[model samples]
Target: MAERPRTLYDKIWDDHLVHEQEDGACLIYIDRHLVHEVTSPQAFEGLRVSGRKVRSPERTLAVVDHNVPTTDRSKPIEDPESKAQVEQLAINAAEFGVEYYNEHDARQGVVHIVGPEQGFTLPGSTIVCGDSHTSTHGAFGALAHGIGTSEVEHVLATQTLIQKKAANMLVRVDGRLAEGATAKDIILAIIGEIGTAGGTGHVIEYAGEAIRDLSIEGRMTVCNMSIEGGARAGLVAPDEKTYAYLRGRPKAPQGEMFDAACRYWDSLRSDEGAHYDRIITLDAASLPPTLTWGTSPEDVAPITGAVPTPDSVANPAKRAAIARALDYMGLKGGEKLTDIAIDRVFIGSCTNGRIEDLRAAAAMIAGKKVSERVNAMVVPGSGLVKAQAEAEGLDKIFLAAGFEWREPGCSMCLAMNPDRLAPGERCASTSNRNFEGRQGYKGRTHLVSPAMAAAAAIAGHFVDVRSWR
Candidate 1:
């Protein structure tokens, strides 16, 4: 019999399967487990109460990011709850014998960023974290996703998880991207086309000329938002870009071992005739700088467009939802996107906080002052990213441009840290979500690429970045 053709997700899933139940649930072995301060405390406590030892301490890595302050790390964490979460992760990592990166450690950063930076995420492996952005690891061709706290404890005790296989979906973007458009725009466009429930039961595998052209960092940005699209996870097949990114990392295989690893990674792509449950094709060249207008990631439109009217939507429920979102966003129907002035701008997150993202934003705003009406800041994804940005003078450019160059952490991405928006403040942000109060109490977020955010910061309003001079 001929060998069965399989997708990247299928191949990885089968390789990790330990058992299959009649109800369609499967026992899958998790090769990598990433823990962080926010979700691991209760998991560790659970282990302590039950007296269960971590099955594979060496395979797990812990870091502090979500609740860490972005200013003056020397001072103690000001938020009592944040301080407790950070301190508890340290105690848990030590007690469980897991490798840890504390706030003072240079390697410490967002869990997703730290994983790929250290090469702990690899092709053809199952990776899980207690954070939704764990899908970021799938960019390297790993089967990765977020799990609840209970599942986190389960994985710690057994190094395995119970899951039902998700359908395979293909999102292919062909042709060259227009100038000023980026991986962030591509993803935003996808969610806009498919809506939030589009990938609810699927594992989306991104492939095509546009996806292939993206650097590993770009791919990471795309996969990082997979959760916002309502997908189980998203991935890109491992190729030269993936191997090159992993070649010399601290935890990646060395020299001859790396060569052998590359050979295996080469076979991690979907077979030529593999079947997909669904497929979505896009013309990358047609995609413009995209942005989210409403609270949901699905509420997106191109930069050249105007705010949509709720009356334009036929569905009453959807129309009401759009009305509510518009009211909250302080936007009126039919207003030009560029007419929407912003009070703040934030350029950083697991989605766009990489070095490349910083460089792009810096280049766009170099020698230009931020709008006097706008308060803007840039936060690097990791401590290492922060160091690299400073070494290349990216920090100088941002500081000179009137943007705050923050210390590394998940600052402004969510309300877990001090970096946040004031009530009713409208911001052009590069972070993933723009949900109500995601940044702060009643804060309004409009998701855009780093370059677009930088442009908006300078203009004090949304501008078509492609035409910005």
Candidate 2:
């Protein structure tokens, strides 16, 4: 008799199963748990009510990010909502004995960014954060996901997650991406091709030459949106790049432990004959710095593509989505994507908030100042990235080019940080999500690669950077 073959997703999940509940769900161990201000308060309070302690406080890490102002994080936050969330996180971390990385910790950023920087995420582990982009940790070859507030509460009480096994979906992007086509572009293009709802009930594993060549941050950018692709999680096989990225991080293994861990990580790659339930391939040469002309990331088109005419949409459900996206974006169908002017330029987020992203934007903006009509800013993902960029003079290049060189944090990514668009202003953003009012009241967002955002900052419109490059 032949035994059922196990896909990589199943292998990882089965390795972590702590117990199976009566309802047919398995409670799996979470090797690393990352927490942010907005979601942890209620969960910690739930523990207080139940008189339960964190199942493993050492495995948990906390940060004050979503609710803190990025521009002036050194001072007390003014918004009562923001202050309460940030302060409550301080209290909760203290009560529960979880290590808290506060606003000026030099390690703070988006919780997703901080987790990897802290080396808490490792290969072959299962990680969970209360935030959706927890999938970002999958870049390190982990089975990770964002859970609900209640699930966060449950994990804190039990150190395990009740989850259903997901099918495996292999997404292989082959060949070399041309110079200006970045990780952000590759992801936006994939979402545009697969639609926003394509990978439901599945776990995605990225492969192929282009994906293999991406830096840790670039890999993180793609994996960060596996959820946006409707996948439960995403994984990239551990390789030299993954090992190199984790080499000297705070919590990563050291000396003998590091070498031994590498041996285990070496075994985490998909087998030569590994099986996946579904597979999709993309040509890297086909990508360019892209943008979402409408609403969802799936509403994206290469900067060269026109705003889709609703009547021309092929899918009935997608046609309605196209129409709604156009309406919310204040654009008419069949409009030229290039003619959609931009009022602001944002170049940072967990999605595109690393030194390489800043370097790409700087490379495009050097000797070219931002258009007078466009207000632009660059926010680094962490104090570390900010410092590294400054040492390379990228900050001066941006400031001299007329863009504001802001502090380190998730500025303007979600309007939770001090940076934001003025009412009714339109922006070309490197951040994820193009939801109406995502940046502020009535502010419109068009997600783009950092290089594209830089080109738009100078052109003051959504112009394709492949041409500019």
- In model 1, residue pairs whose N, Cα or C atoms come closer than 3 Å (at least 3 residues apart or on different chains), thus clashing, are none
Clashes of 1: 0
Instruction: Give candidate 1's root-mean-square deviation (CA, Å).
Output: 0.7
**Residue 198 of candidate 2: its Cα lDDT?**
85
Model 2 global lDDT (CA atoms, 0 to 1): 0.87
Q: Predict model 1's lDDT versus the native.
A: 0.95
Candidate 2: clashing residue pairs, number:
0
**Least well predicted 10-residue stretch by lDDT in candidate 2:** 2-11
Put down candidate 1 lDDT per residue, 186-224, tens digits, no spaces: 999999999989999999999999999999999999999
Q: What lDDT score goes with residue 158 in model 1?
A: 98
The TM-score of predicted model 2 comes to: 0.96
The 10 consecutive residues of candidate 1 with the worst lDDT sum are: 329-338
TM-score of 1: 0.99
Best by TM-score: 1
* Residue-wise C-alpha lDDT for candidate 2, range 1-469, written one tens digit per residue: 9656666677788789988878778879888889888888899999999899998999999987777776665688888988999899999999999999888787877788888887899998899999888999999999999999999999888888889778889999999998678888888888888878888988999999999999999999999988888988989988999989899898998888999999988878676667888899999997876888876778787777788888996899978987887777788888888998889999988898888999999998899989988999998888788888999999999999999887666678787756787787899999888887788877899998888899999988888777785
Stretches of model 1 off by over 4 angstroms after superposition: none
